[model samples]
Target: MIFLAIATCSGSAFAYRPFDGTDAAVAEPGELEVELQPAGVQQEQGTRTLIAPWTVLNFGLSEEWEAVFEGRGETPLVPSGPTELMMGGAFLKHVVVPGSLQGKDGPSVATEFGVLLPDSTGDSGVGASWAGIVSQRWDWGTIHFNAETALTRDHHADVFVGTIIEGPSKWKVRPVAEFFYEKEFGLEETVSGLVGLIWQVSDKLSFDVAFRHALTNRHPVNEVRAGLTFAVPLRFEGAHNR
Candidate 1:
């Protein structure tokens, strides 16, 4: 079964959406973005529902450099032996576009490369993961394309491609959509889409709300996600004089 919902509100362009899930679409250097997501679902075999909380933080180091940290762990409604914990990974991104790219009128393009450290419970000691991103921005919206490859301990390589779109709106009410494809893994080959909104409060602060639903269920654990995101700006003073 497929489900969908839409919510509209009056405000700025940054008011309604999840800004931290997609690393490639985060803010530029010297900026800070944060997200918190709480989701609930019922497993195929389990009669009781489960709730999980996820958090993400992104920081811009320089015009061409950024860092991301994420974590997720959930306690089952019913007490299990140990609450399952999903180890999130930490990664760094380097932008390949010139400073002039930000001032362009039409669709501006940028490239990014990132590395994911081994930090998962299922594959805690897995090898490093790599990803590449291409992003384009226009007056009406922004598009982000990302390709990621993971090297596991068993020498298996998994690859995935994801795309996200943010529509232009006043009062931060931007709608979002995403699709993903993966190969060479048990959880291989699935596509998903989401619609949500963003609210921009000030130049340095913003809030986001989003809804995510899977179009297909390749595994037994398909889910729908509702999340909230927050972004805080980090400013450095008097760096030009040094």
Candidate 2:
């Protein structure tokens, strides 16, 4: 069997568990949310890539702003190669037109921008990216749309568009699906789909599992992912006085 440790891996800064797209929402001020994947597997062309314990940290900067950090550790299952740290980045997300996602009326809107860091191997270079998100919730379900562009590690321009659909929010356990198309200018194009389930255990915690299949330039890639997300509140005693 093949093993991998990559979490919600994507070309941009905002892809979260079970989905390659993110909602138009930000954490509440002084709150922290952690997204973790203990193990994930991806297989392509008779080779397997294993990344263990992918992680993303989100910290609330204000009512409408958040700070994000993402990274991962990749290792060969047989130790054929040295372990490396990859997919590192720092980002900022802002809620622009808060509506349904923020408990208001219409669709919520947000944007994220960041710099992508190089991995330990240095085969990739530093790059930049930005994404826009829109989300709407109905009595039956919720939908999120995302559009993003990035200057890749190889210095190529990459563009991605994705959509996510989730079952009724009232359900403790809900079915989720994501579909996306991405293109790396002068390179390959990818079409991908994912199906998954999310269990909302409590107000502050959730778990998810998903399976994804993608066709890149007619080559197939398959992946399995499982992870959890939890929130914590941060307190600053004298913050109001500042």
Candidate 3:
């Protein structure tokens, strides 16, 4: 069995960008970023850990139009239960207002709508999820704020708000904080925060390190996460840019 700690973090290409609420629904044009986070802990019964990997790819349809595809998988290595795996559901994000941000040079308000495909474990059945994200840039840093909810056949819904604080540094390090509320899954709720450092090694390669801690004990897990992020430019020719 595998014992893994639970950690929550945002999956956006611009790690330095702050929470603007509208940015979560919009996809950047002609951008592809990959993020991988792995964490685990030892349990008294035995040992259990969680392995989660996710990737996001965005394509520019026009100057203001962009298409996005994202996929994520979670595998829990537990001693007694079956190996749980969840997969599928590709969503599309559209930028409602283009060139509304000062620093990121992207849309300020974006809308994201997608469907979650069923998985082998049956933990989350097939359903549709939708959310709105707003992103804005500040003199000190960039901010991204997002609210997401799930509309499924199983009558499940959740709301989440997060902020990313970008520091004044060459590597573009940012600290993140988030609060989550869920009506489904036995009225589970949590508040978590993470401190992360991002280094743009090159135009296409970057590394990220983060420590995550949960503020509420409502959930039976707490964890720290460390991972690397790589961005690959597609159909664009130039020096590696963030």
What's the distance in Å from true for residue 132, model 3?
1.2
lDDT of 1 by residue, 1-242 (tens): 00000111000011113422243344667777655556644343343344355555568787666676555555465435344544335556665554223554433333433333333245544344566666666668777776767664344676767777777634466667766665647644545555666666665555555555443344443444456555655765766567
Instruction: Report the C-alpha displacement of residue 166, candidate 3, in angstroms.
Output: 2.5
Candidate 2: lDDT over CA atoms? Answer: 0.83
lDDT of 3 by residue, 34-77 (tens): 44444323232334555454434455555555554444344446
What are the runs in model 3 whose C-alpha is more than 4 Å off?
A: 1-31, 38-47, 78-83, 99-107, 169-186, 215-217, 236-242
Per-candidate TM vs. native?
0.69, 0.91, 0.69
Least well predicted 10-residue stretch by lDDT in candidate 2: 1-10
How many clashes does the backbone of model 2 have? 5
| Candidate 2 local lDDT, 132-202, one digit each (tens) | 99999998999999999999878999999999999999899999999999999999999999999999999
The TM-score-based order of candidates, best leading, equals 2, 1, 3
- Off-target runs (Cα >4 Å) in candidate 2 are 1-9, 78-80, 236-242
Q: What lDDT would each prediction earn against the true structure?
A: 0.50, 0.83, 0.48
* Candidate 2 root-mean-square deviation in Å: 3.9
Best by TM-score, which number? Answer: 2
What's the C-alpha lDDT at position 105 in model 1? 44
